[model samples]
Target: MPAISDAKILIIATDGFEQDELFGPRERLLAAGAQVVLASPGGDPIQGMVQDQKGDTITPDILLDAVDIEEYDALVIPGGVANPDTLRTIDAAIEIVRGFDDAGKPIAAICHGPWLLVEADIVEDRTVTSWPSVRTDLENAGAIVVDRSVVVDDNLITSRKPDDVPDFTDALIRLVEEAEVDA
Candidate 1:
C-alpha cells in the first residue's frame, strides 16, 4: 500500500457544512498521514452546522477559487443542506468537480455533498450513497443509489451521513493509499 502521508487532500465546503462530515473525515485523513487543506469560496472563516443547527467555525486554508485542483490528490465534499445547495450553484465549484471526475481522481462525497456531483453531471451510471433526502437527487441524475454506509464506485466514494464517517473516511484513505501503489 502507498503511504497516505504523501497525499494532499482538498476539502471543499462552506457555511452550513455538517461539522462531522467535514471535520471527521478530515481528522481521520490527517491521522492516516495525509495533508489536508480546507478551501471555501472566500478567505473568511466558515461556519459549520450540526444537522440544521449552528456549530463550529472553520478557517479555510485557501479560497475555493484560488485552489489548483491539479495540486491535490483527492477531493472531499462534506454534506450539509445549505452547503451543497449553495455550492451547486457556483460554476467554479461545478467545474472543479468535473475536473476531478474527468481526472479519475478519488472524489468523496458524504451527506448532501453529492449534490455538487449531480450538478457537475459526473454521477451518471455510478453507484453512490448520500443523505436520505439527497438519494432521490442522485437517482434522478442517473446514479445507482444505495443505502450503505460507504460505496466506492470507481474513483467516486460516498457515504450516507455523519454516522458513516469512520467507514467513509477509511475508504477514502484506502483509495489514496492504493493510488500511490498505482502511481
Candidate 2:
C-alpha cells in the first residue's frame, strides 16, 4: 500500500463550512504528509461557521468546476448548515461527489456534508452517520444511518460532528491507504 505521504486529497467546501470540520481533518491530513487541496465554487475565499456564528475564512486552491477527480486519491466534505446545503445546489459540486464515488476513491463526510452524497444519489445501501438533523435525510436517500463518532463502510467514511474529527480523519487516512493497496 502507498503511504499517506504519497496521497493527494481533495476537499470541497463553500461558504459556511464548519470551521473545525474543515480545518481539523485538513491539518491532520497535511501533517500525515498528504497533499491537500481545497476547491470552492469560484476559487474564492469561503466563510466558515462555528455553530450559528461566523468563524474564519479560507481561500480555495482551485475552482470546483476545474477539479479533475482522477488526480486525487480521496475526497473530504466538511459540514455546516450552509456548506453542504449550498454545495448540493451546484451541479459541478454534486458531480464531483458522484465522480469520487464512481471512481471508487475514499470519501469522508461529516455533519451536513453527507447532503452532497445524498444529492449525488450515491447513498443508497451505504452505511453512514452524520449530524442528527441529517440522519433522516440519509435514511430517506436509502443509506443505513447510524449514530456514532465515526462510521466506515468500504471507501466511505462518515462522522457525527466536529467532535468526531479525530476519528473521522483517521478513518479517511486509513481508507486512502487501503485504496493505495488496491491500486
Candidate 3:
C-alpha cells in the first residue's frame, strides 16, 4: 500500500463552515502527510464559524468547477448551519459530491455536511450519522441514521458534530489507506 503521504484528499467548503470540522481534519490529514486541497465556489477565501460565532477563514486551492475527481483519493465535507445549506443549492458542489461517490472514493462528511449527500441523492440504503437536526433528512433520504461519533458504510464516512472530528478524521485516513491497499 502507498503511504498516507501519497494520499491526495479534497475538501469542499465555503463561508460559514464549522471552524473545527474543516480545520481539524485538514490539519490532521496534512500532519499525516496527505495532500489536502480545498475547493470553493469561487476559489476565494471563505469564512468559518464556531457554533453561532464567526471564526477564522481559509483560502481555497481551486474553484469548484475545477475539481477533478480523478486527482483525489478522498473527499471531506465540513458542516455548519450555512455551509452545506448554501452549497446544496449549487450545482457544481452537488456534482462534486456525486462525482466523488461515482468514483467510489472515500467521502467523509460531518454534522450538517451530509445535506450535500442528500442533495447528491447518494445516501439511499446507506448507513450514516449526522447532527440531530439532519437526522430526519437522512432518514428521509433512505439512510439508516445512527447515533454515534462515527459511522462507516462502504465508501462513506460520517460523524455527528465538531467534537467527533478526531474519530471522524481517523476513520477517513484509515479508509484512504485501506483503499490504497485495495488499489
Candidate 4:
C-alpha cells in the first residue's frame, strides 16, 4: 500500500467548492509528497468560492464516473454550500464516499463536505465536526457532532471550517501514514 510519501488522495468537488477547503489540503498534502487527484462531476474547470462569492478555478483531474476507487488510498470532500448540496444528489459521488468508507480508507471532509457523508449514510454512530451551519444536518444523520477544529472517528476526519484546514489536513496526513504502516 502507498504511504504518505506516495499515497493517492482523491478529492471530490465541483463548482462553488470552498476555495481554501480544497486547495489548503491539496497544496499541503502535495508539498508533503502525496499524489492528489482532483475529480469532479465534470472534467472541466470548476469554480471555487471563498466564503459567499467566487474565489478561484481548478481543472479537475478526472470525472467522477471515470475514476476507479481502488486507485485512491483516501478521499477528501471540500465544502461550500453548493458543492456538497449538489454532490449529495449525484449517485456516483455518494457511492465513491461509501466505497472508501466500506474499505476502511481515510475519508476527510471539512465544512459542508460532511453533507456528502450524511447523504452516503455512513455517519450513523460516528462522531464528527463540521461548519456550524452543518452541525444540525450531521446530527440528523446520526453523527455525534462537535464544535472543534478537527475530529477523527475511525478513518473519518472532519473539521469545522476553512480556519481548520491546517489541522484537518494534518489529521488526514497522519491517517494516511498510519494506514500505510498498518498495510
Give the per-residue lDDT digits (tens) of candidate 3, residues 1-183.
677889999999999999999999999999989999999998668999999999999999999999889999999999998999999999999999999999899999999999999999999999999999999999999999999999999999999999999999999988999999998
Sliding window of 10 residues with minimal summed lDDT for model 1? 174-183
lDDT (Cα, 0-100) at 70 in candidate 1: 88
Please state the error at residue 27 of candidate 2 in Å.
0.7
Give each model's clash number.
0, 0, 0, 0
Q: Write the per-residue lDDT of candidate 1 for residues 20-139, one digit (tens) a residue.
A: 999998888898788999988888889999987899999999887887888999999999899999999988888889999888899999999999999999989999999999989899
Where in model 2 is the C-alpha error above 4 Å? Answer: none
lDDT of 2 by residue, 1-183 (tens): 678999999999999999999999999989989999999998668999999999999999999999999999999999999999999999999999999999999999999999998999999999999999999999999999989899998888999999999999989988998889888
lDDT of 3 at 125: 96
The alpha-carbon deviation from the true structure for residue 70 of candidate 4, after best TM-score superposition, in angstroms, is 0.9
Q: Judged by lDDT relative to the true structure, which candidate is superior, 2 or 3? A: 3
What TM value does model 4 have? 0.97
Error of 1 at 22 (Å): 0.5
lDDT of 3 at 81: 84
Q: How many residue pairs in model 2 have overlapping backbones?
A: 0
Model 2 residue 148 distance off true place after TM-score fit, in angstroms: 1.0
RMSD of 1: 0.8
Which candidate number maximizes lDDT? 3
| Candidate 1 accuracy as lDDT | 0.92
What's the lDDT for all of these models? 0.92, 0.94, 0.95, 0.93
